[model samples]
Target: MSLGYFSYPMPVNEPVLQYAPGSVEKAALKKTLAELKKKQTEVPMYIGGKAIKTGKKVRMHPPHEIEHTLGFYHEGEEKHVKQAIDAALKARQSWAALPWEDRAHIFLKAADLIATKYRTYMNGTTMLGQSKNAYQAEIDSACEIIDFLRFNVHFLSEIYKQQPISSPGMHNRTEWRPLEGFVLAVTPFNFTAIGGNLPTSAAMCGNVVVWKPAHTQVYSAQMFMRILKEAGLPDGVINLIYVDGPVLGKVCFSHPDFAGVHFTGSTGVFNQMWKTIGENIANYKSYPRIVGETGGKDFVMVHKSADADVVATALARGAFEFQGQKCSAASRAYLPSNIAEEVKARLVAQVQSMKMGTVEDFSNFINAVIDERSFDKISSYIDNAKKDKKAKILVGGNYNKTEGYFIEPTVIETKDPKYVTMCEEIFGPVLTLYVYDADKFEETLALVDGTSSYALTGSIIAQDRDAVILATEKLRYAAGNFYINDKPTGAVVGQQPFGGARASGTNDKAGSMLNLFRWLSARTVKETFNPPTGYHYPFLKES
Candidate 1:
């Protein structure tokens, strides 16, 4: 059926576009945003390549402007989850049997579509639905998602080429088969790229997927599903559904054919899923592969010789961008006493300068958190800090929810190194600072490593080469993705494959070949060119 060995060259990362004032991209994005706000559309679940609409509809609203209606999506019940699984199993064999090059081109076409025709729609939907600013939306919904698609195709192709060596008398080869059954992709709302990558990565590996995105992210998620269909993805290959997490898990986890899950969410939820899967291990055909990137209490540590401006800028962008909703957002900082005063002054000024409002205004660097529940959770931490005597507000501790859930970028200075905000993850626009003696760099590194159970991401900013080396070795396991002089966030796809370990996650390193390997099962084939008359080995007959 196949002629020659195929090679897909390594792909370069997609370039991020700047939506500057008076630029063509800026005008196009603004027009797209305006159009999206004016229309209210109805969305349905895609199962087995058919659009299925249940009467139960949930309204969609923008986080920054809750009053405005974006659209409504049909919500499904337990029966629908079962239906999705059945459809996936029905389509699994045909899809897995198709040539790998054909599968690779479908996703490659989808990436090109995102980069060109539907670029604005992707960015616009993300900006409005997720309350992300123009640049954030461009980087996430457009560039990052594009990079994930292209790079994954190349990575999976490279995986197929790996083979075992053979001796003179025999020829050996390996067949990389897709997992036996279906994969479940549970994605979060913060990044549209994560929502796209979770499902497509597994599907690109010849696995059928049952995708359930966060309710808050359905607006953009549906757009991507339509794009996949247009890119020649067959029906039932990736079934999109809307249902409660418990109900979805009840059906998928207990099913005998459930093969794996690709997840991105909170730690508690991931823990519960693992527990349920373990409890139901006897029902499955094979051991399920569970890969997840959970929560992060990411940090930034400044050395005595660090530049004050660099430290200030890193905190400003890392802590406040996307309203600090990123799992990798810098939630805590350890500033040495030598440069503490200057860094504090500069950071306070930067925080004060930020304008918070809707995502339509490109000038506003801060936007609303995801929803009311997230808003309440983030604000409660700030309220508790106001009452505690050990902590004082450095700047920006105000919040309002009249028109939108807007919380100013709040910074807290604490005398206690182990304060609640420092240790716990408050996924919001809040940063807590703890200053230590300049001579206690090593001691503070230990404190930083010991403070949080999460080791997802952290940065060490310093001009002293020795200080950088010291932090690098001492805190080797402190973070899965470590940074120097730069912010802890903004990991590029091929250059920096992202994921973490400990309570953070399994650290499978998504956006790399390592993640793709989880979706495959290999079978080795060995053929003997010549046969002997007797069914006996040389050692048994000769000596």
Candidate 2:
């Protein structure tokens, strides 16, 4: 029995070119995604009603632990970004003027169309570009997008029909409408669902969006835009561009028509965007809105009364799903001293048994990290943990790059709760375990809040009714989705709106009506038929 952890190359199902310099499949994939041909062409930056090819390009690699080039994305320049912004500004007037039902219909049709024709491409792209397993890619890239688009339409309609009160001898009504300008949306590469979220939320509210998608998954974003357009979304209503952060921020911040920004990324980037918005505050034509969902170092707190089997399953999913790359991914666990040994045994057993292989294989529970950069980061963390005298590798922690960026599911047991590994966001298939005495349950909860910087997603496994209630109430701020005897990941749409608090996010919780309100501005429209030919004048005189 090897306790050192296992690593494997991502096996390919079809013929894939060796990640060589100029292979035919490599060229073909790039061409298919980027070049605009007589039939299907490679993708480009959608700006000002046309696809603009860039002088520079970004290369993408297959995530299946296979040696092949995914494709290249057009590295859009400042001009393209500005053009996209201009187009969005121009489109907003007509889009905002459309009746609410018409606006809702566009999103509904777009959602159904994607589920029909484009799901395969979206899922396959995530599997290749994001290094996610088949199930993860399908869930994040295809199903979640469909959920947001469909659910938001219903939510928007309900909000649209809401009306305000009227007073005696007077008529008054209030309505919520789109902001009178364009919205700038910046998305992360971790989930295809986010691509739909940041832009679709505003677009559904009749605000045209100038969207800058993650360069890594630009192909998936392009496919989404095409589907929306085909479903009768007017051109320019949802413009897509690709450019680096600083340059794009300048356009988003300085433009008078840039009414708001919807963002999802790191805390550092969010801070920078917030500062830029501030600097331009005096020059802006309107008070701009900036909404963000940032980083997380999420935690899972467990007690001795918990079911060991349930804890094992929850730990496996929370720490290893998507190779632990999600912002809401749980990176640390706190266990009671009495059951620490039992919990560790079950966790190790489940982690060691997980298959590290291809997405299409269906049985492999884990897959490669998103890229070599992430692989190196996770690998460094494992090495550091090994060097720490207080910590020892319990199950798996190894890396192999025979094909793509692959790392084994890793669990490290730490004696000292104050260790840095227990505090930081490992953002990989790496989990740090800390044990405490059963009598110190409240102490353990405090330790969880102190060590973990995020309150994104977490869980507790306990059978005692009072204990469950106590843990849930105490750790309410520990996560956006706090589960009892269940995995923290795999939050279902419509049932649990997902997002976090504190350093995690704005707690808007995607997939619900609450998030829709963030994208709209309230308007009060009052009409008096000339005071009913001067009838209202009597009330005014009496007052």
Candidate 3:
């Protein structure tokens, strides 16, 4: 386990389980989810290895079943933010001074724990709290999180092993130093994996973190901290808090020791934070690094030569998986008019076969959107599309939230490519499609580019080699993660690093070396072997 001066280890993507009927994974997930559903507990705010409870509380409920209470979290105030930041700063010196190998050992152990010991519990909590089905929960809460930990461990070593090339007379070295102060990780609620990754990656790189996960994700976020603690993460290294966004921002952004922010949320919130940082730039000891991944208006373009079944399957899975909550999910599409009907028929059948209900049901593929707010926003879009003259509800467009925040997988076909649904980021299980004349393939590509400001994820499905090559070259900047004959969703950890350009994000591809670079500052060192050190250079000699 301890062999190497410098070498790159191949990072493996954690294999996803099928969780089929009567399989071990299915049985384990079902058993754990039922146990969690019956238990109502209080989630505490952890700071410096201690759990502090506040009187004010936020009751937690499953997004799919609103009536059922999963748990309650201790709502933190402004005081907690300061305390967390202080806690992180206090732990900074010892954590950063530790050897890189020692730090790598802790995170590698964490990866093993998540992949083996805590897999079922984490997946079950994600399914119940976040409304992800068995398969979805397994891929996100268990597999992806494990991959992040393992790959980051390797990457951390890679960073340390990197040194500047030295000349014959002098030796030069580069040090990747952690920031002088604490890091703040503001994570989203969609993927429990990202929620874990935002904080852990920075902490693994020897930076102390003040992690504030989205309130809706606290149920699993609590479990995430538990696993990290069990895996031997030290006290005060990562101070976990649950405070209001404004309160947290006001304090953290204004603090002198606020070094950086690892954020994955809405563009509006990110932009506001960016402005605040700029306004308070003079207050910080060092320049703060802002790394974020925001909104996406992803698309799927189908050429005439595509396989109808493949195109339909891709749409069904890409647009409807996790209720289309991924930032990379396909929200719009362009199809050739000649084969539109054939593709539509197959797509409708695939959508019709999906079951929308609670995550406990193994047959159910579509679950509820995150909560009431999301449910309302998505329903309004569907309703508005129904009233539009150029739009038609081709297959599914039904919604009921009495029992749970349920919205059926909806498909809106519109004659106008500029329809609101086609351009906007709905972040729901709704797909808007426009069928174009087969000859206007190039023109349609231009429409896709100009349609939305967010350039996140997209796919081009074509059997013809020429069409595939043309689309690849033409729409290079359109998507950060572009697919060929496949769906835009499900970007893997190592193989297909994910992010986008434009309004989508800063395009710092997570799970890659580039993302890690943002958390580091480089310093070059030089030492001369000879004692003839003089300020004058050889070039100063006169002939």
Candidate 4:
């Protein structure tokens, strides 16, 4: 069927647009945003490449400007979940049997489409629907999504080329096959790129997927689905549905054809899904691949020799960007007492200077949180810290939800290392700081490691080489994505394959070959050039 070996070269990461004032990209993005805001879009469930609309519609609103209407999405019931699974299984055979190069091209074309035709649309939808600013939207909805698609294709290609060695007179080869059944991709609301990557990455490996995105992210999700369709993705290859998580899980987890799940959400939800799968283990066709990147109370550790300005800048950006909704966002920090006062002053001044408002204004660095529920949850911690004597508010603890879910970038100075705000994952623009003795750098490293159960992302900021080395060795298992004198966010696709362990995720490394390996099942074949027809050996006859 195939003639020659095909090689897909490694792809470079997409360049992030600056969206500076008077720039063409900024103008285009602004125009797209205006167009998106002017009309109300009617979205539907994509089942088997057909738009299935139930009358049960949920209103979509911008988190920053909740007073205005964006659009509505038709919500589905439990039966639709069943339909999605059936549709995925029906299309699995043809999709898996298609040539790997064909699959690669489909995603590659999708990447190009995002990079060219639909770049502003992608960023615009994310900016409005998710309350992300122009720059944040560009890096996430445009660049990161494009990077994931291209990098994943290249990574999967490399995976296909890996084979086994052979002995004399024989040959050996390996066939990398997709799983027997369909994959379930459960994506989150925080990152538009994650929403795109989870489903496409699995589907790129020749696996059919039943994708369910966060309700808040459906706007951008639908945009991405349309792009995939235009890129020539086959019917039922990836079925996008809108249903409650429990209802969807009820059907898929118990089904015999449920092969795996590509998930990015909370740890509690992941644990529940794993437990349910374990309960129904005998009902499935294979051991389900439960891959997830869940919650994080990510940290930053500063040494005495670290620059105060550098420490301040890292905390300012790493803790507050995207309203601190990123799982990799630095939520906790341990600073030495030597330069802690100076860092605090600079950080406070920076936080005070940030302008908070809607994403329409390019000048505003801070925007609303995702929703009312997230606002309440994050505000409660700040409120609790206010009442406790052990914790003191450093700056920015105000919150209001009359028009939109807006919370100030709050910082709490805590005497206890394991303070509630430090231990718990408050996924908002809130950072907790704890000062340690300047001489106790190693002890402080241990404190940072032992403070939280999460090991998602963390950084050690130090100018002293010995302090860096000691902290690196001491906090080896503290984080999956560790940084030296840098913030623990903004992981590039090809350079830093992202994921974590210790309740963070399976650490399959999404941007690398390791993730593609999860979707594949390998079979080895060995053949001999000659066969022996004699019943006995020459030595036996002589004896």
Candidate 5:
């Protein structure tokens, strides 16, 4: 069944709700959190409409308050992974044959469900599972995910409407077809929006998906799966699983039915997957599409003439929000010696004023890093910097994980521009700075531009138009999502379609038509009218 050449509504980004104290949204969120606290749910690996129990459970704990158990989820083995792939392939025929309008409606309705009924539920789950505060959860789990769903459906219609013009005697058109086999979506723990978008984007274009969500993110992912099912997503359309990375990689790469992979994670993992796919290239039905966004050693450069206050606030918000877990988070900074003290003073105040604790306390600006492994890794970087002669602890290098994996927002200043912390990606709330002579702005720009292999996002703060133009021109390739005076984080859908090149994976800008195009393989169809019975062409006639 199909709707009659339906035109979709104009897409608008969902506004992020500020969950301030005493507001209705805040009150609703609190009530939902309380209700969730009373319930201990068992999340199971889902396959072909059945919840399969694997006998091993991974307990879910709030990263901010690690001792408190929110719930636990079953862990899957090879059997379950193969089962998910089998189910998706089995459903591929009917699912792919369904009308595009039918597939579009399911996701469009899911967008509304996330916006209205499932708002508080997803928010509560993201806060507990990811340690995001109320406002953070609102922006990520609810607002951004809703935008991804609505905008993707809108873009699908736009793709289908694109047709080729033909001459008077002939008619020509193109049909966009989904991949012949399954697409695997491997999502990250940082953004709940990413977890949902990666899989649904492929499936919305009429492909089957076997999604393996990060174990740490599975709690909220389970909630998202429930939302899709409620929104009328058919069984076997998207199969959710929980398994070790190597185990899944072995099975997925070797299968002749592997068609594509939509991934967002570490750079190392993406490269390894690429190698495996290349080795098994001869086994696949088609050359699979590989789309990924990986680790970023993102940066911010502040000119001497820039506003110190604006620079300070940008550093505070950009580097520390969501505990510096965003792929675009500004991790390294270059400040001129002229504004060094003023910018440093203002940034210190911002960090000191921030409250750090559990998400239950809405007032807390900082929460724990994702888990203990991350906590230890970030601390090691700080500890190494503290002992190094070239670096000095500027402010906030404290860490305590007695009850939770908590680390204070840290800032390290270095005389050596090549300090370890300045180049490596810590993936936590650690920002490093290198002050340069005001006269050497060009040199400093070069340093900042070349310091990292990853080029996901970066920003320049300047009032000087010439300086701004210079920075913008020189550092153009340094970041995919470049900023003028604003910070590097907080890229909205539609406006700033996000992704990066170089070591940051393929720069397939998500949340846009370019990303939707990746899932479809187009075929051109041509027909001739008033055909002559003779096969000879007019060009063959002898003059």
Candidate 6:
């Protein structure tokens, strides 16, 4: 059956007796909420110039609860990945030949289309498909994607216009241009924004892309392609392939025509792909570019002078947002001993008050973890933490896998700051709490740095100006994103560039000029009004 957009009932009409003293305000709010809930759809994948119902099928269930099968989609196989790759390669010559301005038009129109018809669909998919709550799915993931597409279009134009001279007298100049081949974009399930940016950046730079989206978010990625097609993107310009990772990895590494790769996933997978490409490098016509954002062990530091309330709230969102699947999630939090109890109280209160349910309800604050594997991993981690002499499970450590993948938002307190959990990338709604003596601020900073193999994100909370400045400068190498008063995961498009270095992989800095550069190459073309005399060029032939 063809799937229409996903829709849910409005969260209106509370029990009259339970309704607060503000009846007039409540009535008005319900009216607006109803209108918004009415607009949503579940879109399908579009590949090779058209939307296709796959030969094989897989049932998609709500990440929150597995009782009801939300929908089933065509399970793309090895053949589909190759077909998509061929489509991308087939269209490359013509697409890359288009003027830069024309290429920019597709992205600009895509942004507008996304801001319109795709918004509700995108939000609904995030909720049901990825286990994100309504507000978090719609407002954060979907909105940020639209904003990224718009801002990146303008940035690409600016990059094109920049010209610097190589010499004063000679008619020599350098120009940045697109790589004249295909880019294979392998994305993650964490954020919708990264999904759009990974492949679209290459498309914006006049390169056709074969994009393999995360299985959990195939629908979200499909809707993205739909918006671009609606925006008048040329057929075959950007191909969407829905195959499993290992199969797609083979095609990407083996294809001699492939020019670049933009990947976001685990460090293990990234290294394997890199090795595969290296093995095939000699046979390829050109040196293929690899850009990636892998795993992270993000941290949050609380100074003695910081407000406990703010730290609690920030840590709540940082550790629990999208159930902590984000690369920038605060996996480890360090607080001063003086404020530890107060911060713990506030965090416990907030978490306890939050509602937990599936996306269909649209009223819950917490939703499902991703799948059975993720649920198992997180639950096992919590179990293992119990065996550690220095570890204690603080708030939640519950897991329910009889249905969909569900894990309670858990917090663990460790006696030693260097506990193994504090050093690793849990990549779930699991937060490790560490308390340090106030005087050992520097020592605590070094502790986090030493423990983590990843340097993707780290933040320090402090009211003092000097403290904030010192933290920023001292921990410069610690994070691609560093937060002060706000949460770390919500990095805006134009303002903050995302990604990191060290084991976190390439610091491409998505949504900034740095990432746009990765999709492009350079060229020089000169036409001298007066032709130079034959022999001598620069220092050659005895000038």
Winner by lDDT:
1
Query: Which residue runs of candidate 3 sit more than 4 Å off their true CA positions?
Result: 1-8, 533-543
Tell me the deviation in Å of residue 477 in model 1: 0.8
TM-score of 1: 0.99
User: Against the true structure, candidate 5 has what lDDT?
Assistant: 0.92
The pairs that clash in candidate 6 are: 5-41, 5-42, 6-41, 6-42, 66-404
- lDDT tens string, model 2, 89-203? 8888888887766776777787777665665666666666676665676677677787787777777777766788887666777678788778889999888889977899999
Predictions in order: lDDT = 0.94, 0.77, 0.90, 0.93, 0.92, 0.77
* Tens-digit lDDT string for candidate 6 (434-464): 9899888877777766787788988889997
TM-score of each: 0.99, 0.89, 0.97, 0.99, 0.99, 0.89
Which wins on lDDT, candidate 2 or candidate 5?
A: 5
Give all candidate RMSDs, comma-separated.
1.0, 10.0, 1.8, 1.1, 1.0, 7.4
lDDT score for candidate 4 against the true structure:
0.93
Name the weakest run of 10 consecutive residues (lDDT summed) in model 4: 534-543
Off by over 4 Å in 4: 534-543
Instruction: For candidate 5, write residues 28-126 as lDDT tens digits.
Output: 898998888888889998898788887799899888888888888999998888999999998888898998888888998998998999899999999
> Compared with the true structure, what per-residue lDDT tens digits does model 4 show for residues 461-497?
9999998999899988888899999988999899888
Clashing pairs in 2: 19-67, 33-42, 33-43, 34-42, 34-43, 35-41, 35-42, 65-404
| Model 1: colliding residue pairs | none
